[model samples]
Target chain A: MPKHILRLIILFVIVIGLFLVARQFLIPESFGEYGHYRANSIEENANHDIKYVDRAECAECHDDIAALKQGGPHKNINCQTCHGPGNLHIEDPTPENIVKETEREFCGRCHNKNAARAKLIKQIDINEHNIESKCIECHNPHEPWN
Target chain B: MELNKKNKKTRRDFLKLSSAIAGSVAFYSMFKPIESVANRKTDVTEREHWYGFGFDIEKCIGCGLCAKACKIENDVPREPFFFRTWVEQYTIKNGHIIKDENVIVESPNGGIDGFTQSVPDKEIFKSFFVPKTCNHCYKAPCVQVCPVGATFETPDGVVLVDDSYCVGCGYCIQACPYGARYLHPEKKTADKCTFCYHRLKKGLAPACVDVCPTGARMYGDLDDKEGPLVQFIKNHTCRVLKPHLNTKPKLFYNALNEEVR
Candidate 1:
């Protein structure tokens, strides 16, 4: 072979070698193990701390309130939906940690009259629906219809 | 010169023979039946689990508890614009479902604050609330458009984003037809629902489904033939969002209004 051809072959090999070495460093170890993404990411995405506890967890301790809620219109509603996340309260069992929303505005979030709301949901004009007293005073949140 | 000519002819003949063999091999392989990516079976363990989601529009009361639960569960931004899930109220006037002007859609605070009537009762021909989230499509456009391989579909049929790998390109955000993806303001990476993958792994339902007071939402493994999700799909005439796009979305809706897009 000519000297120039030998030099070109050496240069080509060096370029290919550099690319192979670079790929080892640049590409992630787990890439293409499952698909195109990093395999470890699946575990990472699945490892977040569960902020919302199941209703069964609340029922474990508050069986009385759970029993009251069971027969109500809001039977299907999770306790944490209104009280906020109960994970912290589950650990401490403190009344201060869990919210006790009694304000009309809090009730108005769902109960206030809205045309977009489904006809099945009980809605009322917050202004005219017994304005003087809180919702819990007249309508028991546990069994509102009763 | 005689020897040189013979050597050249032999080399040319070898090249031709090798080329013919290569061509024949390529031609044979082309005709051979190969399993497509869609039909390819995953591992037995992975095949045993395939998640699906559905909701009943008739049952949804626009309570917004699902929206609130998702935000708190995922630690999504509190701003009205940012949402992993949201509820949209569609109001149609004069029963003109086809006309764009006849329909009015609103989702104030992503319907975390309960919806109020916008269209008058007299003009309103029909109206309903639609809770929207990532569909986790089988052929997801977001996964296809991601400049980096940060977004991918798992073997068990859940689409997920690798936060650490994302380059914050926003390509996937724009590509998603359902408007499910959003750029995380703090992380600068594209973020969306994971179908609550963490909770699902722990055998818990997605946060939105967990908080649905009216039992509007349903979720279960499709691999379980007796699962509620599969049963719901079997019993109800379910429809997906933008079926023409061919995303093959896993999210199904029953009693979905034709006006809803």
Candidate 2:
């Protein structure tokens, strides 16, 4: 064969070989192992400390509150909605860590008057709907009507 | 005579060498697409569940409970601008008198706080809240545009970001028509709703669905013919956002108004 053609063949082989070698190193160790993404990503995402303990977790200890909340308007609301995430409180069992938001403004988040809201759903103007007292004073958070 | 024979031999050898090179290049080119096909055919027997989501506009009360739950559940940034899921309030007041007049759509702070009315009650004819989230498109432009394959869809139809591999080019964010993605200022990677993948893996509902006061949102296996989601789709008139784009979004909206765009 011609010397130039032989040399060109040698160069092509070397370049392609380098690309194959680089691909081995460049690609992630777990790439395309599970799905289109790296397999480790599933584990990485799972590793995040779960902050919101579902209502069942709260029911384990606070069954009285759970019973009260059942079938009520706020039954759908998770326990952590008013009280903060219960993970720390569940782990430590401390009053300070688990919040008790009895403030009127806290209740006003959903209850406050908004013209955009549906007429059928209950809402209130905090100023008119008992401005002098906290929401808990008139209504129990667990079973508000009672 | 020997010199002539030598010249012919060399010419024949050169032809063989050139043909060999062309054959090798052609073989390599042929395998390129096949390799991608092999990548796509990775084992998917483990993920039996295929998820799809639905929203009932009639049920949503613009309370923003879902948005708040998502932020806390996903550890999204506390900034008002960031949201994995949000609610948009569409108010059409005196809509009959005027064309698209007194129509207001707003999601202040991603509706983290419940929406307040901008137009007066007297002028308003009708209003409804439309919750928005990542559609998890089957032909997701975000996944297609990712330079590093950082954004990808799982076997079970969830679009997720491999944060470890992401180069944060912001291409995926721009590719999304529904504006579902945003760059996390702290993580420096594109962030959006995973449909709460972590929670789903743990056999829990997405945070938004978990805290929905009115059962306005539903998530379930689309493959399950008997599932409530499929039944709901069959019974109710549903539409996806921006069907004209042909993204094949999985988020189905019931009672979606034309003005929602």
**Best model number under DockQ:** 1
**Native-referenced DockQ of model 1:** 0.67
> Candidate 1's residue-wise lDDT over A1-146, tens digit each?
67999999999999999999999999987887777789889899999989888778999998999999888898888888788888899999999989788999778877777766667888898989888999999888988887
Error of 2 at A57 (Å): 1.3
* Candidate 2 lDDT, B1-261, residue by residue in tens: 987775665777889999999999999999999887776653446558879999988888787878988898898998987889999988887757357666778889988877667777788777788999999998999999998889888878888888989988999999999999999999899999998888887877887887776788999998888999998888899999999999999999999988888
- Candidate 2 TM-score versus the reference: 0.88
Q: What share of the reference contacts is kept in model 2? A: 0.45
In the order shown, what is each candidate's alpha-carbon RMSD? 2.9, 3.3
lDDT of each: 0.87, 0.84
Candidate 2 chain B weakest ten by summed lDDT: B38-47
> fnat, candidate 1?
0.68
Task: Tell me the tens digit of each residue's lDDT in model 2 across A1-146.
Answer: 78999999999999999999999999888887765568778677766666667658988888888988986878877787678678798888889998798887667766777766656667888778767889898798888775
True-structure lDDT of candidate 2: 0.84
**In model 1, which regions exceed 4 Å deviation?**
B1-46, B95-97
